[model samples]
Target: MDVSWAAFVGVVVLAYLIPGPDFVVILRSATRGWRTGVAAALGAQTGLCVHVALAVGGLSLVLSRHPDLLTAIRTAGGLYLLYLAGRLVLATFRSAPGPDREEPAPGHGDRSAFGQALFTNLLNPKAVLFFAAVLPEFVGGPAPTWAQVSILGALDVLLGLVAWSVVILAGARLGRLLSRDRVRRWWDRTTGATLGVLGGGLLLARD
Candidate 1:
């Protein structure tokens, strides 16, 4: 019961608010439809669940101790992001033009959206480091360490889901404009470029 609830929420909220691959994926997918956006949000939280499990079970600590494993994961994530970026950029150039489109049919491509979001988050070194490093800072008093970590992780996931839901709604509002082929293409290119930069940074970042 000695948890720093206020500080925990504040930090988690700030983390979610930062622009990252998860945010970009949800925002971009929202432009197509609400289903995609929601799926992506769910996917991201699911990945967060994995992180929470790791933190609660103390595996995250193990990962932090093994620098090589962390580096491997980081490299893989960076490569994956670059792959996604290249796909988006190439598709923009290769696809033929089309008229403005309606929201995609329900369930159509939702699986892909979800999977993309899942890895976008699951492979994130930041998430791994956050769990190993930050989540422990809020633990205090006589409570069990796992219990405290579980509570903090749950709060993080809840706040993140809510924040992303709001972002999805906002992006959906802009769908009308983005539905235009030229605009959507440009948007994809922009996100693709962003992912590319993030990937490169992650690859180049120091421990």
Candidate 2:
């Protein structure tokens, strides 16, 4: 295969090592149930498909040429993150759960988790930027750029799914400890605050 995938694999592995919004969503959902966490992972990866499609279609290059477009996207994504954070924070104020609320069954709130995870990943401009800027450098094969990017981007998403599954497995084990009302309250608060910070950083960051 002419695809220079060694460096690309290295990048993907490094990315898996780092934590991002997806990580927070999966682990949080797992606190509800491992099944919920799996749904969240699916939604997140589906959102990743949009970014990959954009990169494969060369829309990323267009966005790069027009910084304003990217800025607009980044702003929207940041605002969305802020909105999710606000909701999480407000939820903390609600009447507390019993000592250990039974871990939710598979169907309960799984759809909601998936929806939230999908949008969280879909709206982030940084993802497309990575696909546009970093992905191209790794495309050295004589094949069409679109073809190469499709394969490379697909690999990234596949690896992401595997990584999230591993996280979900670990988080399911931790979910037992986190199920206590007091701990969950604090956990939600911390995740909310972190999301707020990330959103603010995105909005303030210069191109």
Candidate 3:
């Protein structure tokens, strides 16, 4: 294909760099341990794969053509974000060991985190729209549209993984700081507020 490799890479890199719910989720998981952090990142990427599949199979086009379907997805996504926010806020009030206590080793939490991150990405209508709007830009080269789109989608996933790995690793380094009960409580409230704001923004978003 005659894709603009440099341009595509630059755009994708910049997009991944912009922190969002995905970043928040990964960062929060990182506070638990490397395994949870990686699981969260993988789950998010896996959700992106679903979007890519939908885009490739023309499902995204169908959704784009049907405003109702798009609206439904967006509403669900927004509500889910609100639910997540509520959970985070509630976490701040839950009883837990003091910060000085030894941190628990990561376990089943990683599995649930993977699912949470996966659904978080999947429910995001913006991500679906992103694939629909941006993938086509690189589809008119030597290769067929499907092939080009597939390649671009793969690249997006790869870059996303790489970018999130950095976030997870860096956040892991700060795990000790985050483990502090006071700091953790503050972080939970802050993140909860951020999620609530984002949910509200998405709920009011227009097509």
Candidate 4:
């Protein structure tokens, strides 16, 4: 696989534009608080990196060998999305206060956020499929597979982090315009609905 800088950048751009769990989580977190948003972003990226590693290491090979398991994973991922969506929608009607409803109340307890982000991404089997399918496109035969995967993994983390950070920063800015409670409620509902739609979409997807 020959490495073209332009092609690589294009792939990254496209991935950024593609709507998925990472984007939804980042937007939700950022609007809530920078710490949570960054945490979720880093967490999701960590998961992506892990999936890339697994793909390069040929864990996907095992998965491929077991089509039933793969299907189960896909199903689970879809269900998880639905569950998250339901949670969000339920929260929309609740008087409860979650991270989203909170203010810019400062404190960079980013470790927790990072862990949550990482867990969400890691648990997402769709991300695993994504790495299996998309990661190989960037590599050439002469290049060490691990080396190519490493580069791609690094790119995934960097691009994903940067993209989510920008989103969060922008949300933070917009956050100042609305009352904390209103912003929180609006984002919660929006995220809940978005997650629901995404979940349903995922269920309907085939690949």
Candidate 5:
């Protein structure tokens, strides 16, 4: 195979290292607990698997060829991001009636966090396009195109998992430091604003 495994690994490492929605979700979930963070990470990986399947099936090319379809995906993704942002913002305003000493109810169940992470990754058009563009670069090699793409896609997921694991662990450490009610409030607001901006950016994105 003509594929440069080293280069591919380097690129995947860089991509996941850059902070994005997936990173944010994993960090936030980790703040709640490691279990939630793991769930969110797994969920994101599951979404990546979906994209890999699409790439292997050649649907990524089809979407690229059809701008309208890509636009549709972008719009749906943007709306979902906006929805999540709104929820975060609203959560910041909500006051728990109980004392601060009482631990806040768990923010989200594992299933809920998983679903959120899955949808967040799946809705991201950039991820789809990334796979579409990059997978082909390694495809013309001696090994079958499908096999190469699958292997590369799996590598992508593996890199993402490793990167997110670090993010989760670090966030968990930070979460402990910021567990106080006042600090937690500010953290929520910051994350909410970040999500809002990302969603708005996605909405304005042009193909």
Candidate 6:
């Protein structure tokens, strides 16, 4: 693998700093549990692989030729982010206040957790399109594209896992102490606001 280590590091670092569906989903999972948190992270990363593959497979070439199309995709992604944020905000207000109100258990073990995580990632259009745009910049050719895509994809997953793990651990600790509806609602509102900001920023991004 003749990959550029510096380029790889830059990509990983930039990706970790950027706000995306994976970040939100992982944060959501962490507050729930390690099982669900890990599941959602892996699932979301797997979906990201699909996006990278599609981008490197030839779709990126088309996008490069037609920046307008890429812009359109990004616009749609921004809309999706707004929708997700809106849902979270709505959930915050509608949730009943009580100690009995708890997040549903994520299920038995790693398998269930992984499935839930995967489903959430695959369902998020913003995640898919975000990867489509970003990964292509790193992998800009058709030569040995699959191998290149795999390398970048691996780095992305690794970095995401590292970042998400920290979030999950912190969230789990905090969640244990403050297991109340009011706190949960506040968290939801904060998450919603974060999502909204990310969406707005992405919308303002230039080609």
List where candidate 1 sits over 4 angstroms from the true fold. 98-108
The top-ranked prediction according to lDDT is 1
TM-score of each model, in listed order: 0.93, 0.91, 0.91, 0.81, 0.93, 0.73
**lDDT (tens digit, per residue) of candidate 6 on 35-88:** 667776777777666666675576556756776876776666667667767877
| lDDT assessment of candidate 3 | 0.82
lDDT of 1 by residue, 1-207 (tens): 698788888888889878998998888778778888898889989999999999888866697578698888789889988988888777777655545644222222678789888998998999988998888888888989999888888888889988998988987898778756678778888988998998888889778
What is candidate 2's CA lDDT for residue 30? 75
User: Lowest-scoring 10 consecutive residues by lDDT in candidate 2?
Assistant: 99-108
lDDT of 5 by residue, 109-165 (tens): 789789989999999887988888866776665688888888889989988888888
Query: What lDDT score is found at residue 166 in candidate 4?
Result: 84
Report every candidate's CA lDDT: 0.83, 0.82, 0.82, 0.69, 0.82, 0.66
Q: In candidate 3, which residue pairs clash?
A: none
Collision count for each candidate, in order:
0, 0, 0, 8, 0, 1
Cα error, candidate 6, residue 135 (Å): 5.7
Which predicted model would earn the best TM-score?
Answer: 5
Check candidate 5 and list the clashing pairs: none
The true-versus-predicted C-alpha distance at residue 6 of model 5, in Å, is 1.3
Clashes of 3: 0
How does residue 173 of candidate 6 score in lDDT?
Answer: 80
Error of 4 at 78 (Å): 1.7
Which ranges in model 4 have alpha carbons more than 4 Å from their true place? 96-116, 123-126, 180-183
